[model samples]
Target: MSNKKEQLFDIGLFKRLFQFIKPYNLVFSGVFGSVILIAILGVSTPYLLQQAIDTNLTNRVSEGFLFFILLMVGLLFAEFVFQLLFIYYSGWLGQSVVKDIRVKLFNHLLRFKMKYYDNSSVGVLITRSVTDMERIADIFGQGLFMIFRDFLTMIVVSIVMVIMSWKLSLIVFAMLPVVLYATKVFQKYMKTAFEEVRNEVSNLNSFVQERITGMKILQLFAREDVENENFKTINGRHKKGWLKTIWYNSIFFPIPDFCASAVTGLVVWYGGLASVVDGTATQGVLFAFVMFIPKLFRPLRQIADKFNALQMGMVAANRVFKVIDTTSQIDDTGKHIAKNFKGDINFENVFFNYVEDEAVLKGISFNVKAGETVAIVGATGAGKSTIINLLNRFYEIKSGVISIDNFDIKEVTLHSLRSQIAVVLQDVFLFADTILNNITLNNPEITEAQVEQAARDIGVHDFISSLPNGYHYNVKERGVMLSSGQRQLISFLRAYVTNPSILVLDEATSSVDSYSEQLIQNATDKITKGRTSIVIAHRLATIKKADKIIVMDAGNIMEQGTHEELLQIKNGYYKNLYEVQFLKEEVA
Candidate 1:
């Protein structure tokens, strides 16, 4: 939203951008040569016309006229050939550069931490990858080549014009500053307008995408009409931003036309007077000057158009750069290892906050032995999930040490650390992929037998086997093809195949029917036998058999004991929750 003009478009950005084209230098060189040839052919046209006027016409020589006509035809043919070659190479380079840019941007996104995704919207990132990349594509496809071709043509035409008649050339050259100044002013407005268009586009995409994803809630609440109005308001703003950009370009294209006309009128008046009074500048030279003015203005117009495209490209590039430039708060300290993980986790005085000055997890201390099963119970926002997130280093604690097997998690590489921990959340996300791929997502090296075993252990293998394609059956986006219990079962298999040293189940069985829940609970019991497991339960009875159960409130542990021990107290919050759940079950 800030003024883009205030930011320096320095040589460093250019250098980094050009580095992507280094591999295609040969193609670019061919493109460059063709552009130069095209410029030469254009400049030669005016001289050919002048010769036809002065000698071929006045002498009434048929052969000279034929030769002049053939020469013009040949130059025209050559120009067309070069133009074709330029088109081919420019397209090749544009697609190649854009492909590399997208790859780098996506890889950069992977390196960012969970905090980045927590605050950013899916629509904004999608727009950056899709819309912004297309804007940059224009820079390579038309913008860069146009600037090169036109600037060369302009310089060559100007030098030849001056050579033909310095006096007339000076009249035209005097108008150069007018063109430059006008372009400078137009560029400032274009830059701002284009940036506004891009920002608005991002916002509009976010609004539409979020609304579409949340349509279920809207329909449930019967607020479709309200959402539609809200969407119209944001969409109207996008329309206005795009129209302002178009208005700026409408003003931009005319400045060059006005400058060219003013210069041409002056040239004809001055050169015609010199020819009559001094006979110094010939009528043919004056004629060539008139013809050359158009040649100059054509490229001038192209340069202006390219400048406009360049400003938009720069706006997109700046947004992409901003994303790539951000440093993730979590960092690897070069102490990563692929093995020797025993999952002896200890959280010592851990504190955290999603925002500054408001702690979500406050000075909590706990330890899980190498193969202990621990359960955390709390009301919503009581920091049960926050503790698990910190243990996995999804977020770094503000002040504390989380260690696995006596090694602080901060010392391990993110990939190595993550490989040892697996999480199965209440909301399971399944890509539109084969069932086999979903289960083996955590360990691609897993064999068919291992994947099948993991699925069987999680009680999803029978469901998968019932499908026409069995393990190869496709689960559509967000696992829409599967039932909720099936989706949760697949998520369980995804975790189980990793053979993780530690596992965190946050309301993992909350969505399943009682029968499916019992199946998942049986699997959880087997899987946690020798692994350090942490279960955050919404249904208190689910964790009744856990080796240790901790009751929490407002980011603090109110009691730490077994479920039966907490029940015996009969006066705490845990006792109230236990009595309510038992009563509900008995009545059912």
Candidate 2:
């Protein structure tokens, strides 16, 4: 019962949905005009046929026969015109609404906090923004408006059937109870089926997207047969969900069809009896009711199908609206606009976690003066990356004061805050585009020559220029065509071109070959000079020349000093980590 209540037309939900239609009032007017004309013509067809037979054919008069034929022809042509207008307008309206919704949903997603993405599935988001959006459009195309036309036609036909002959009308409507009962049962089951199908689609999509993205891992580990079996399980569930809906459809449709036939036969028998015995029914009235039977039950059966679409649309809309209504956003309430930064940064008593009660960073404190270089060395999951994410305001801290140049970071606009910092990550990501476009990120203000100069400044100019198309060379999706080292080299150019006030190198040379690592090392030294720099490093070579070194373990600052200063401490965390990790690298 609760599920059924949810599928009922929530006035507020539809009111919001219909707001998309309000923009195209002219098309809406055309659809409404078409529906009314179609209804009038629907009843007129049967009445005209009965009139022609009773009046013109019964009198055996040729005089009025041609007029009836011409009138019928006129009615059909008008029906065609209205139907063409109806299809054109309704289809146009549906497409237009979905297009707007798709854009709005995408833009909304862009503002969400990184924390939201940390917990969300890319495939589920894709389903909501793409697949579900298409379903919502059908509410206008084949769901709501079509059902309205059906109901309107049914109501008009019902009135006329009664006015012509109540006895015949009563006989025809006797099947309504049985048909309505079947439809109620079908709708109850179909709604659950469609909901399950939608869930399965999201699961299937997420599975495929994750597997495809990790294809390298999949093949390297030789997990093909295992993944294929898992895929079959997911795909089987998707098929079963759709089949459940089909099973109900198979049972439900025949009920209406059988009821229509039964009602027609019963109407004819009663009409024949009335005409012969009571003299209250005419042959014309009986013939009109027979014609009206199909018109009536046809819409009834079609309404059942449209209800299925409406159920799906409503389910999709609820999901979409729920996402849009989520308040997980990095508040950009500060009005301050920043053109550049002096690069002084401070973090005091910062605490953060990706999950509740599972702290990833705890009471971390650090400071970097303008144009100073600070290197952070720690094992993976030591909170090195969390500091970088916090500096850019990617996630909100539980309790902290993070400031740049004496201004609270939270009191600054996100664009202004992020624009000043540039990072080159260990696992570099490049879009499928020309090197120059990926570097500039389509910013029209950064000319190609500026990028070239930045590339030369970082000592990677020769490598980029040697590429097939130099700066114009397309990297393809995620820079798959390039070696891992080459992708990181490109990322160096990307970070350097911006000439950021603060520079971050997140284990930048960790995975590179000797040649690319040397090039990246040179790029780092060239870019980090006279800038506020934070280096998260595994290689001793990356941290040897830092003005200050902060060693972290389990989110706490364990030691702070220069290269030689920290090594002399007895039983220090940095000393143990260096002996265990970096000492071997230097020897190699």
Candidate 3:
């Protein structure tokens, strides 16, 4: 969504981009050397042709003719060699810079806090990483270095033309001011058009990504026609954005072609007349001037086109830098390594809110001893999941403290802290990978034997063995190949294999079949044994055997005790919720 229009030649942006190329100094130096050699050699061809015509061809001398012909051929071959080297090195430099940039950008995204992602569009991020990065690479591969070579060629040609005849050079120079003015206008208009193009591209990407992700919802509601109509509108805007650039190109590119032709005609007409009138211009000089004029104006024309790549690259860099400059990272100032936490968790009057001025957990406090199983039952939006988020430090607490084993959670390294805990949620996510890889998550230290043993211990080994490939079975994207209950069982095994010191089950068994529920209950018993476990479930029946039960209503703890002790409270929140919610679920 960054709409900042960067200048055509932004020094700051280029400086940052060049840092990525610092490691490839040798390759870039080779490119620079090739450009210079090509420029010097490119001018030699026309000059050598002029010499051949004036000295050898006109006099009908065979010796000089053969020598000049061989000399021109050698110069042409050298120029070809350098041109090839320039192309190869420039492409190598561009690709190398892009590779480093992509790695850095991805790493930056990985460190961003969860809140940053909550407020960002995934499609826009993808555009910046993939499409925009390509634009930046084009600036180097096809724009900057080539522009340098072309401009250098023009400069060399100009100096030689002036030396040959100052009067003819003046005529060519007269057309320049007009061409330069037109180029300025073209760059101005094209920059604006390219910026709009990039913006529309991001918009189109965002729309398509959302539609694809939510296709099931659209189908379920039978809104395909409506969605398609909306897509057409976005797709149309994207088309218009690109068409605008083409319009400017059609107008601007022709002006330079016209100038090149006019200069060539003027040189031929005026120089030809001068030769007949006073013998001031030679036939060889006129011929060389005609050729050199186009060479000089050609780069000027191409620069106008190359400016598109330059401007687009700067705009893309601006957006990319914005992401890299974002300051939304979780504070990991804690030096505690948590090598041996005792699993005791304490929330001392902790407060939190996902949105400003709307408290989700208002002065909530709780405690769970090591090796205790605590069940938290609450209605929807009663902050059941918020507690789990807070314990894992996914979101920083607004006030008060959350600690494990008397060590403040914030005063510990995130890796060390989260390494000791695992959470299994109701809506489990599985990657498109083999069952063994999904369970072990490709951890080299966690062997196949270890995963199989953990699966066996968790009582899901028989269920997995029933599959086509057993542990090696491929679970397609989001585990769409498996049932919801089967996905939950996979998640349970994944969590259990890690051997987390503290376990969290956030409504893990609330949406499973009766048969899968039995399997999950059995696995839950094994995983939660001798660990501090926090179970968040709406089903009251599942928490009957928990060491302690905490009933929450509207962000406040209504009751906390054993199941029987809480039931003894007359007309308590837990008693009513248990009667109304659990009874209906049982009857169903």
Error of 1 at 129 (Å): 1.9
Model 2, range 159-199, lDDT digits (tens) per residue? 99999988788888888888888888888888888889999
**TM-score of each candidate structure, all chains considered together:** 0.91, 0.95, 0.97
- Candidate 2 regions exceeding 4 Å error are 1-7, 272-279
lDDT tens readout by residue for model 1, 48-94: 98888778675666667878889999999989999998988887787
Q: What is the lDDT of candidate 3?
A: 0.87
Write candidate 3's Cα lDDT for 309-395 as tens digits.
Answer: 878888888889899889887888999898767899998998888899999888988899999999999888899988988888888
User: Which residue segments of model 1 deviate by more than 4 Å?
Assistant: 1-4, 7-12, 258-287, 334-340, 586-588
lDDT of 1 at 19: 85
Task: Choose 2 or 3, whichever is better by TM-score.
Answer: 3
| TM-score, model 1 to reference | 0.91
Off by over 4 Å in 3: 1-6, 584-588
Q: Using lDDT as the measure, which candidate wins?
A: 2
Tell me how candidate 1 scores on lDDT: 0.82
lDDT of each: 0.82, 0.88, 0.87
